[model samples]
Target: MSRQRLEHYLEQMTLDEKIAQLLQLAAPFYDEVGDEGQITGPMESLGITVETVHNVGSVLGVSGAEKVISVQQSHMKNNKHGIPLLFMADIVHGYKTIFPIPLAMGCSWDIKLAERSAEIAAREAAVSGIHVTFAPMADLVRDPRWGRVMESTGEDPYLNSLFARAMVRGFQGSDLKNDKERVASCVKHFAAYGLAEGGRDYNTVDLSERQLREYYLPAYKAALDEGAELIMTSFNTIDGIPASGNRRLMRDLLRGEWGFEGVTISDWAAIKEMIPHGVAEDEREAALKAIIAGVDIDMMTSSYVHYLAQLVADGIVDEALIDEAVMRVLQLKEKLGLFEEPLRGADVVAEREIIYCEEHRKVAKELALKSCVLLKNNDVLPLNKNQKVAVIGPFALSGDILGNWSWNGSTELTKNLAESMKVISPSNIIIAEGCSIDKITEPQIHEAIKVALKADILVLALGESSEMSGEASSRSNIKLPEAQLQLVQFMKQLDKPMVVVLFNGRPLDLHGVYEEANAVLEAWFPGSEGGVAVAELLYGAANPSGRLSMSFPYAVGQIPVYYNHFNTGRPKPSEDTTEKYVTHYLDIPNAPLLPFGYGLSYTSFTYKDLVLSSNEINETDSLQIKVKITNEGKLSGVETVQLYIRDVSGEVVRPMKELKAFRKVELAPGQSREITFEITEEHLRYYHSDFSFTSDSGRFELFVGPNSRDTMNAAFRLKK
Candidate 1:
């Protein structure tokens, strides 16, 4: 059906049916029904009442296409108007063909691949009868301690923009109306949830307009530009108002300013949490505030379902507001092609065939390998096949492979790194669980040291699990969990050369390991194929190319560290320097353990001679900058050539440097490549007071290199 036809169909629905369409119901874990039906979980549960069949607006926590179809059909069976329910799930990464989490994919710096991954996710999700995916979390993070940062694309607006647009395209496809299985992308956490207070999950966000526009908000606009059909508001508040009930954010900026035509959704129980935010007296008041603020759907919240109509009856909320929100909700269901064939999408054969296909695994492996950044290597990496390797860590044997926000991740069929290595090279592998990820005993340390003594090579797997650091799992200190670090220290006592394989969700402090490990590979929470990918990189099957998207702080006390930090009038030059009255810390440095865009490879690549074709430009002029890179080592490698531009001064205090453009290039040993970056006027524009974007002419600096810290700089000037 056309958008016109869908709109007409929605207009024809009755008020009760419209209200039913607006409600999103809660269900238990999916998998109760056989093929050919939408399996609403309550049908098989013990406490289900007759009201469940009639009053359920939608179903949550569902799976399988046929089961969803059965559940939706069941929902319509007892309804007066037979309105089919919207089936929602946390399809954060992927549906069945699970891709890498957004952070790891962000590390890849390959927008096309990210887009393709989403495309496959959308295809698999849609085929399974899922209408929407709560994905492309576009929130920007400066604090790596925030566990949910793992869910975001990364800290840079430019990188987030590309990934957000790609994910939106992947989920929505070319058109949702014609594509039977095309799922709508939901832009999440409406505003800056990334700068959560002290890096705690679901904490408050406090940001100035200058910071909000310059740092956050851009990726959201980009997703909106790409036609994201739904949006999930953050639990975090902007200023003092919770995002779910913040009318200025949801209504003013999102709806009016950005002109987003889609429905706005509350994160799970976020509307109810407004009471905790102190904005609402109770759940009833929370419902009133949220609907008044223009929220269209309440996910897993009884706030809207239990009290929205009551709020209308009490005149606390205008009926027109309900109509407007209900309209958007019904309109989105229409966009999902639900109106034309409400009960026809569930396909058992598609579900059976699509989940965990070889192609998906190949893509998963590619993304996994691409995400493994060689942070440091001293000619000890790319292990020889003949070497005897000892793999140590609790995670190596545990079923804790997947990172955060994984909907259905399991290690049931997965080969842990130790097992995977044996498959690739049978005779040279040894497995030993040295220490737990958390607290460890002295005997564990003794065992680890013993393993190192007998081994020619060691691969230490260390990082957080899928559960330890996401959503409710924020950590104050984002170092490797204590026990494992002690094990690393113990292993360092031995003379055997070792490699540190990090499987973390956030940028962790590897300060101590800088001197201890011979080689370090950042294998950020790679999904199912994580082990296989790590094995390949360790054995020289794949070269490490991924780079850090967020800066790893030296300590959590240096919370909001990044490469684009502003220069204080009296900026501290170095950590060694003392502070009399200047901005310098006595114990810790202001700098991160590693800067953003930081990554290393076994093969050394050198960047030289920054070049710019035009320094002065207008809205119409294009600035071209080039940098020469040579692969100085004896292997083929890939490099992400980053171009950063800094505006000396502006109408607003600008970041020290903003990522202008970056391109990933492939080069063989002894080969040279010149990468050019096109800087348009839009790249220089900043959101001014009154929200109008304007640029100022000034002397600017251009830098290009392996990472933000390792760059060669030059100057250019902008003209009026």
Candidate 2:
């Protein structure tokens, strides 16, 4: 349908019908609508009539071709204009063939693989009649205490921005109108929901516009730049106003400054929560403020449906605003080609054939293989196949490996550690559940010790369950359960080679397990074929290449530790410094247990002979930075070469180091390669005190290395 036709539909809709177009309800509301157009079931409490349900713009949390087809058929029969309903769901990482969570995908540092995972998710969802997926959550996360860190890529804005664009391209593709295998992408938590105060969910977020623009907003802009079809408002308050009702944030910044013409939506029930947030006095005010703030869809909220029409009638809200919001909804449906084919890609046969298929599972396994970060290895990894291995702990046989937001993933189809290890070395593996996640008895501990004594080595599988992270699951003490720690202490008494395999959602404190274990593998809730991938890495079928996107803190007190932190005036001198008066922790080091971009490969690589094409460059010119990398070990492996820069002096303080660029290369034993990176003025730009984004003329330092903490540095100058 053309713009003129969409406008025509807007003109044809009555006030009530137009108001309904701005409201979004769950699948249960539509499922209970009677044939005579009366509310009969779940929606009765909201006082919503069947007529309002018939005109609802979209449905949430519903899928499968049969259910979607039935609902669409019923809705069209009652809808006066016969406009099709849009189906949206939380297809975060994958729809059915579960892949690793977004944080694990970030650790892989493979943008193409991330895009491929999104493509597979789109294929499965489109076949099941899902038109939009609330995914590619681009919030820049620095605090691991926030449970939703599992949903974000990492701490660095540069890396997260790259991933945000890749996810958008994967979901929407080049032509969403014609591609039946794709679904429109909804980049979410619109502004910074990750910086919630104290890392609590839905807490207040207070930051200067300069701080917000510099660190948090870049990833979201990157998503919009990639043409993501929709943006969802965050639940937190930005500068004392809820994001759903902040006109300066939504209308002035997102729509005005960024020029994002895409649809704007609220996170589940965020529009109505403004009253509790003390911003709106009643539902009428909530509806008025949200629409004026450019929110087009109120998910799971009755405020818009009940109060919008009356507010417009009383001259409190403009009818033009309602027309604009309704027009955006109609334009989205037209972009989806809903007029020509009401059921865009709904086919029960296709849903069965495409979802959870072998091809999709292959990608899941491959990504899982790359997502496992080998955090520590004291020469105990790449175990020999003939060695007798004891896989002990709660995760040994548990199939709850698919992390949060995997609603469609089946635990029955997921492979556990014991199952996959047996397939790799069937005759030499033993298993025992020494303790549960939180509790342990003497008999269970005795049996676990007995099992450990029978094996040549122990693979201690442990960590938080799926409930520990994602959404409202934040924890002040981010450590393993006490029972698991006690289990580790008991296993350490056996004096055997121990490899701690973590199945978790966020970066952990790892105090007990890190010091006691011989090797530690951060296998973050790897999805679907997680077990198979870990087994392959254990036996040397695949090498460990995944790096940490988020830092692992030394202690819980250092809650928000990250690599690119700003240098304080009274900074700690060095590890050997005896200066107690400086800004240093008395008990622990000021650094993280493991830094960002930190990982290990079975094979080793060495960096040498860093060189620059020029020592000084103007704004228009670019500099070529080069470094030599060699595989110094006797195996083939992939290495992520990272480049960082620092502004020696600025109008405002600058970070100690910022990741500017990075590259991944595979090298065989004794191989040498020189990688070159081009740095332009764009990479150096930062928001000033006036909120202007530009680079200043100053001296700079550049560092290139395998990780953030340990690197060789060279000096350069930036000329205006």
Candidate 3:
């Protein structure tokens, strides 16, 4: 399965066989039994036949060792060259032991943990016969209205880039040649899929080329730099061209400028979608554009299978392009060692032994604990074990904590808050299902209140169900569900200390519930052992250290609010005072309900004594900034010290602040640590108005604090 052999195999392939390698179908196409197993969503209409299915190079959405074995055996029997069919699935978070969603995992701010999660996912997925995972979705999301925000890391380009590298390393590992536990990583939605217009799914994205490079494209670069094996074209159009067929994006930028040699695949029939996108006249034209644009695989589409051979025959498309695309596909199979053993890691014994095993669940539990963000607290957390506790809400005893993209995971394994808490103190805990997620009845409220009256403390577990957040689930109004809000209002009348444990996939506008609850914990779809993790935080077994990766808007009016927003000509007041003509919201404050990088712990850390090695820095030189942090509160905790920088003056306007660097440190009570950050010219450079990625000689402000909004600051000058 060497390069030489791959080339030889390509040379022996017929025009139709080469075209077959560029086409990918689903589990249904391989079903020889009957039409019952056939997925007629779009394939049947495409006129794909048994012959075309036999020649398909890869299969999508098929898992399990037995199923994959059956499919591969059937495919190889008919594949004249004996090229193995690549098995790909959307194993986003975890395979069996579901971990926190990507957004929540980003909140951990622990890159090592993020890497471990991907590694675990790779191991579990590989054993189940999945050769590729469309993961480490390196899209930078700012608008919460986008339902797919749950799939991305967060809003910051720098943070997303860091996570992108970590996940790639975790998925592919160091050596794909020898690694059995790793699966190939496909860094997806190649260009700005997160910046959909109106914050709607698959909407058009329009941005200046400068803005594209400055804010969106960095994460994809980071992933590719870390050796991601493949790139998936986004569903949206860049400018006016669909990403799957945009030659400027695929050939000029990705292949020409970036020098990416990996295979590029269209995202779930995106090539055929070019017709609906108004770029192509028909499937023939779509196939020509995609293959010419260097797309190696047509995922779940028959555009290549139906048109490519004829297009090549008619001289509309070159056969060399077909060979190039087919070669890349074969090269990936060689790299994955699928050419050597068709069933690479499909060991049924290993699949059974490793899936949701105790070791895997322990890591899942640890990640879930680290991902829970403490949004607000009023000396009511760390509930006393002896105190009578009432766990009242829809999620209190429900096992629906596993988030989206948990393909092979089981909710049956998920523990509820009440179930986990009962293990700590069976005699002191009372439980009641207040109401359904979006429903509240008088009888349900009365029953919840009856249980609340007997308890010294009330833990209200609330928020959206798992279905309300992932793909195609965008919301115009991000407020709490009406029935859940009603339940909260009813519980407010109980006069007991209440803590709100929220389970959501996106950042919510918590206007109504934030004021009524004594403490609020953003659990954010913690997976598998989520309930146990929440119980641990409630009883002081684990200190909550997760920070907000995406800003929680104060209201839905401030939809696209983020930390790194450019200043306007007419700026709003920095203070709480109102101004008539200044840029300010008429109804709500300009700030978010909770700012980015904001989180609370059982303990507290105070920062002081900011000192710089030099007040001035040259273009080639680096400056070191030192800050002292002390754990002031009683309990031990982990504190994420965040560093932000802002250009005082530029050719164009600059954001108020941009996160450059951060570190998470664990400290015991009364312990002091000095954190140092090295700032260089590279950190100061940005895409100028004229598209030059260079900085001007100017004064820069540096802020070091717990969150973006509250920080101690200093100023320095950069001498060119």
Candidate 3's C-alpha runs over 4 A off are 31-45
| lDDT by residue (tens digit), candidate 2, 220-332 | 99999999999999999999999999999999999999998888999999999999999999988999999999999999989999999899889999999988888888888
lDDT of each: 0.79, 0.92, 0.90
Which of candidates 2 and 3 reaches a greater lDDT?
2
- 376 Cα displacement, candidate 3 (Å): 0.6
Clashing pairs in 3: none
User: What is the TM-score of each predicted model, taking all chains together?
Assistant: 0.94, 0.99, 0.98
**Winning model by lDDT:** 2
Model 3 root mean square deviation, Cα atoms:
1.9
lDDT of 1 by residue, 1-720 (tens): 465754564577654454555556665623453343344455433233344335445566676776677776765666655556777677877765566778989999988888888887777776777777888899998888788888888889988999999989887788787887577788887889898898888887888887798779889989989999888899999989999899998899888888888888888888989997899999888988888788887776566656766776777777778677766766776666676677545688877777778888888889888987788888888998888888998867754667766666666755578887888789988777888878788777777777777789888988777777778888887778778888888888787888888888888878667668999888888887888888899988889899988887887788788888778788887778866566867788877887889888778898887888876777788888888999998999998988888888877677788898888899999999888888877778888777778888888887887788878998777777
Model 3: weakest 10-residue lDDT segment is: 33-42
lDDT of 3 by residue, 1-720 (tens): 567888889888888878878888877665452323332334565677766776778888888887787777766777778888999989889988899999999999989999999999999999989999998899999899888899998999999999999999999998875787899999988899999987899899999898899999999999999999999999999989999999999999999999999989999889999999998999889988998888999988788988988987898888888888888888888899988899999888888998888998999999999999999999999989999999999999888888767868788878888999998878999999999999888899889999999999999999888888988888888888998898888889989999999998999989789999999999988998899999999999999999999999998898799999988888886647667788888888888889999999999899999999999999889999999999999989999999999999988888899999998999999999999999998899999988889988989999999999889999899998
Tell me how far the alpha carbon of residue 521 in candidate 1 is from the true structure, in angstroms, after superposition: 0.8
Weakest lDDT window of 10 consecutive positions for candidate 2 = 32-41
